[model samples]
Target: MRAFHNTVLRFAACIAMMLLASFVPAAALAQEKTSALMTPELLEKVRRANNECFACHSEEGVKKPPRADLDITKLRPLAHDPKVFNGSNHGLMECTQCHGQGYTEFPHAADARESISACEECHAAKVLRIEKQLDASVHATRVKDKFTCSTCHDPHVDLIASTLIDPRKIVAQDNQHCLDCHDSELEFAKFAPDDEQTSTKKKRPDIDKIHEWLPNTRVHWQAVRCVECHTPATKTLSHEIVNKEKAERQCLTCHSASSSLTTRLYRHLAKEEQERLGFANSVILASSYVLGATRHPWLDRLIVGAFAAMLLGLLIHGLARIVARIVRRKKNHG
Candidate 1:
């Protein structure tokens, strides 16, 4: 019996050694951390492919600039952190996924195949079949930014058990997920404290505390999904529309209005104000942002031309009226 037990113990030890050999070494894991940590080598290799994209883009550049503006030799680390995207998953994703061809190498960015450089590469089949049902939802549109797939979805820790797919579900889940990060804005910090060791977390901040800060939409937006009000069209990752339309719709929908367009011209952007909006609106008040818009010479010319045309027409009509009145008087006198 002792001889048999000794042989069994030796077999078990050999099996354990083989199992230990199969495990990933700490060094390999550290290398992955280097890549994910945004090390100089990785950043340089990625930046080398397309560096000359900042010629015409006002203040914005490739954080991913377009191919025409790209210059391969001038990539540099940004001095300031992008606020709207401060903690966003875009920080960890690969550049090549969005930037495309020779992006991995120092080649001309113009050679990028615009069509294929989209979410469709991985999700095209799953998305195409579904959007076919929804009449091509906004989710199907190709993205232009230089973020990778892992930006939103953490590739390192994908638990297949709770995979989300539906757009509405995805948005709702994402909104809740964002709240986990943005609780300070919501004043929910009292309840969801970050400490994991003590077991004592603060209570949920009163709805009143929340109400006092946002003041207006705190109650209503609490019930609605955050994404619904903050319709983000770009992958730039900042959603800051005040949902003036939503507030407008709520007023029109409930408070008795003749039409949904009851919102005055001042409430929304004018035709020329389109370019003035985007990620900047996320930080500042909407009204204040509109007030600070830069006026172009063409805009002044347009306004002057409109006034000139209106005055000219008015003068022509007045002259015609005076002539008709004199002719009528002459006829009566005759």
Candidate 2:
């Protein structure tokens, strides 16, 4: 019996050793595969390749997009397409946005595949941090649909549109975008807008209208831009060595009148100014207060309709008061 027990124990040990041996080769194969696909040197090559691709594609275009309204058929650098270089917008993104990955080596394009990192990537934290402070602190918390860094701020080229193109304007789109995502606006009746961004954009669509109309507006109001006031929260701004360098504010600092934000805001100017100021939160409030105003989307119709009714009521009251005065004046003259 003792001899039989020793034999059995030896057999069990052999089986365990065989199993361990089997796993070793498999693990080695896996490691070899990973090493084959990726390496520090290879990654550097990819990065360098990507930068070259972007340079010509973005700064110099071979074939300009028709929608961009810029003709570049004769443009050189056929190897580089500027659209491909303008940073990734998500390939599924759009013609203008250039699908977010920018360009990759045609053969190795798989590396640019969208991942969870795309959503939880560096930009994500940036947006969330700003919003968190916005909710708790003075920054504008309300954000619009599809609220993203790309939404209010563009990452691609160094720009602040210098022309008055409708799409470039920030007024109708900007502050309203801020109001859309703000938690306080939805939960509370109104938010006390403060942060440099929110405070700067406290007025709707464009502040230029106020400044333009003011008699001494140009001189009294220093022109401002979004970047001037809302720089990276951590990286503080300093214009001059004077007075310890006051925080930069106003559009003129970096943005000429032609900045993209200014231009986009200008387009919405043609639209009704007062209504656009009705951000998602204010729209919600309008729904609560007004009646027979909305007949469209559940929230939109209700909110917009309420505000419209109030505006209509005020117009009617003003007209009625004017008519009454006219009638009284006629009676006195007769």
Candidate 3:
């Protein structure tokens, strides 16, 4: 019985050893494959190849001379700064990722635009959401030539969202994107070459001049987002941007107890927190307030009534004093 037990233990040991040995080759194969694909030399070769493509597309590449008929502003559109491109969010991605498969060769195929990948290819959900909003935007409904994602954003030069976290800075950047086309004389000409309504010489409104009625116009623009005024009042931030003319511009729109800024600007704050920091609280916390955001309806009416009563009392007192003075003067003259 002891010898039989020893033999059974030896057999179990042998089985375990065989299983361990079987996994060794598989692990080695996976390591070998990973090393082959991700060697330092391979990475260097990729960097070199990418630089070659940038040479033509970037500022260092051949600068194309402006055609006799071509507008000067249009000429620089093709030129890029390689340093800027490499620093962008898509910097590490290969040129072929968007340019397409055959674009690696010189004098690339004539149909390269067909090969370029749509932004929706990778950002399906985000693109879909923005598309729905954009479709319903004033830009889409009013303009004959509707704007696309590329119209406002340059994929090659635009920075990642993670890098633009400051609310004030973000607003300024977004507003600048709008001004780029809307403010550009050349852009206007391109949009409507034949139409006299959109004359190339016509300049965009001066930000301060147009918004002079708003107190501290420049400061407000810098501190607050253009979308805060331009977009229709909504809780969710989206691409449904309205034209300047349709924007909610009434002082009461923001100053009233039901200010949109209360919800939109301070949206990160919890409902309880917003309530805790009522109208005066918002002013105390942020040095700003929308007049009605925290106002009590009864209190507001009481204050208005009190002010009116005081003014009426003063008017009656002044009239009585004036009559008394005049009567005295008439008696003395008589």
Candidate 4:
């Protein structure tokens, strides 16, 4: 019986040793991989591809005097700053993830099927909302060829919206996006062809001259988004932009007791009654003020009321003086 017990114990020990041996290789392999990091060859390949792609896609790459006859808008070079791109949310992702294969070589083959990724592929929900807004917008209905995501946003240079530290900078950036096409005579001419005109170029509006009615127009443009005036009042803000003529130019739209900026641009900033009203809060008022939106609500009313009272007092005093003068003349004539 003792001999049988010893044999069983030896068998159990052998099984335990076998199990320990089995785990050793996997643990060692994991350690090796962690220590080695990225292979030199792989790093070189990535660097080569980035260099090749940027050569043409970058401002430094493609020389302008782009062919007028050919639709070179897509081919035209818009410089991408590497520092900005690196700081963005999509920075770490490989270029091939969006642009896809065949971009490995320079002067991508003319016939090469460009496999660009769609925004909806990853952000289906956000894209759905934006698409609804776009479908209803004048741009989609009026223009022969509707604008795409790239028309407004450049994937390479555009920083993550949340990453923007300065509110004023964001406002300027937003306005610049509209000005990019609208202010350019070439871009405007492309949008509206002047078949009768010899130049085919349309006269672009001087933004400053057009917005003269707006106090400190250039400063306002740099502080507030164009969409604040262009988009209609809605529960959720969107890109359903209107024509400039249709835009809410009334100063009261933003300066009155019922301003839309609180609901739109300042939505996430402003806080009231324990509820975060807008993006940052009234703290942003330190940087730039939107008349009704940023100011203390009661303080605004107090100022307006005091001004009105003073005006009434002045009018009453003038009327009383005139009446006294009239009475004296009547008495004297009598």
| Quality of model 2 by C-alpha lDDT | 0.36
Candidate 2 lDDT at 14 equals 40
Winner on lDDT (2 vs 3)? 3
Count of clashes, each model:
8, 38, 4, 9
Give the clashing residue pairs of candidate 1, or none: 51-71, 52-69, 52-70, 52-71, 53-69, 53-70, 53-71, 62-65
| Pairwise lDDT winner, candidates 3 and 4 | 4
lDDT of 3 by residue, 139-244 (tens): 6775537466777777666653324434454556667777776667667445433335764444545655677877877777766667778777765766788776
Q: Which of 1 and 4 is ahead in lDDT?
A: 4
Mark the regions of model 3 whose C-alpha exceeds 4 Å error after superposition.
Answer: 1-49, 62-75, 144-146, 160-162, 192-209, 251-334
lDDT value for candidate 1? 0.38
Of the two candidates 3 and 4, the one with more favorable TM-score, higher being better, is 4
Models 1 onward score TM values of 0.25, 0.26, 0.57, 0.63
* Models sorted by TM-score, best on top: 4, 3, 2, 1
Q: Please name the candidate that would achieve the greatest TM-score relative to the true structure.
A: 4
Give the lDDT of residue 216 in candidate 3: 78
Candidate 1: list runs displaced more than 4 Å. Answer: 1-92, 105-107, 113-116, 136-218, 226-334
* Candidate 4 colliding pairs: 267-278, 268-278, 268-279, 269-278, 269-279, 269-280, 269-281, 270-278, 270-281
On lDDT, the leading prediction is 4
Measure candidate 1: CA RMSD.
24.6
